[model samples]
Target: MPIVQVEMLEGHTLAKKRLMVEKVTEAIVESLGVPADKVTIIIRDMSKENFSKAGKLACDQ
Candidate 1:
């Protein structure tokens, strides 16, 4: 089994996330030799305020 964790800023549509999961799972299955059913994709969404870049909060910058 392969577990893939994807963290990104919030606001992506459900369809985008679904496509992301499908593509990621397919990549894992092909590259890592994991079965399609055994590949797990976890998406973590963080608010702009909760994410920082270059020492500044995303929302603040």
Candidate 2:
């Protein structure tokens, strides 16, 4: 089984996430020759306030 982890800022709709996972699964299946059921996807939704870049909080930017 292949596991994929994705982390992005929160605010995406369920439809977008569903499409993203579908595409990701297709890619993994094609590259690894693995079944779709064998691919695992873990999505982490992060808050902008908890993320920062270049000494500036994401929420501040």
Candidate 3:
């Protein structure tokens, strides 16, 4: 079984997430010989305030 965890800032369409999951699962199944049913994908959404970049808070200046 393969477990994939994707963490990113919260702002993605359902279609995008679905595509990602499908592509990731296919890759895992092809590369690791895992069954499609055995692959699990988890998407974690974080608020901008909870993330930062370039020494600055993502939600603030």
Candidate 4:
């Protein structure tokens, strides 16, 4: 079994998220030779304020 975790700033559309999940699953299955059913994907959405870079918050960038 393969577990994939994707964390990003919130606000993506549902269609985009669906496409991402599909592509991620395909890549995992092809690379690890695992069945699609055995793959687990976890998507985490965080506010821009929750992320920072180079001493600046994402929301401030």
Task: Please report the candidate that would top lDDT against the real structure.
Answer: 2
Superposition error at 7 for model 1 (Å) = 0.8
Expressed as tens digits, the lDDT of each residue in 1-61 for candidate 3 is: 7788999889999999999999989999999987999999999999988888898888996
Off by over 4 Å in 4: none
Compared to the true structure, candidate 4 yields what TM-score?
Answer: 0.94
Q: What is the lDDT of residue 26 in candidate 2?
A: 100
Off by over 4 Å in 2: none
Across residues 1-61, which tens digit of lDDT does each residue of candidate 1 receive?
Answer: 7777899999999999999999888888888787899988789999999999899999998
lDDT of each: 0.90, 0.96, 0.91, 0.95
Instruction: For model 4, name the residue pairs that clash.
Output: none
Off by over 4 Å in 1: none
Inter-residue clash pairs, candidate 2: none
List the candidate 3 regions with Cα displacement exceeding 4 Å: none
Candidate 2 C-alpha lDDT tens digits along 1-61: 9999999999999999999999999999999899999999999999999889999889999
Residue 44 miss distance in model 1 (angstroms): 0.9
TM-score of 2: 0.91
User: Among these predicted structures, which one has the highest TM-score?
Assistant: 4
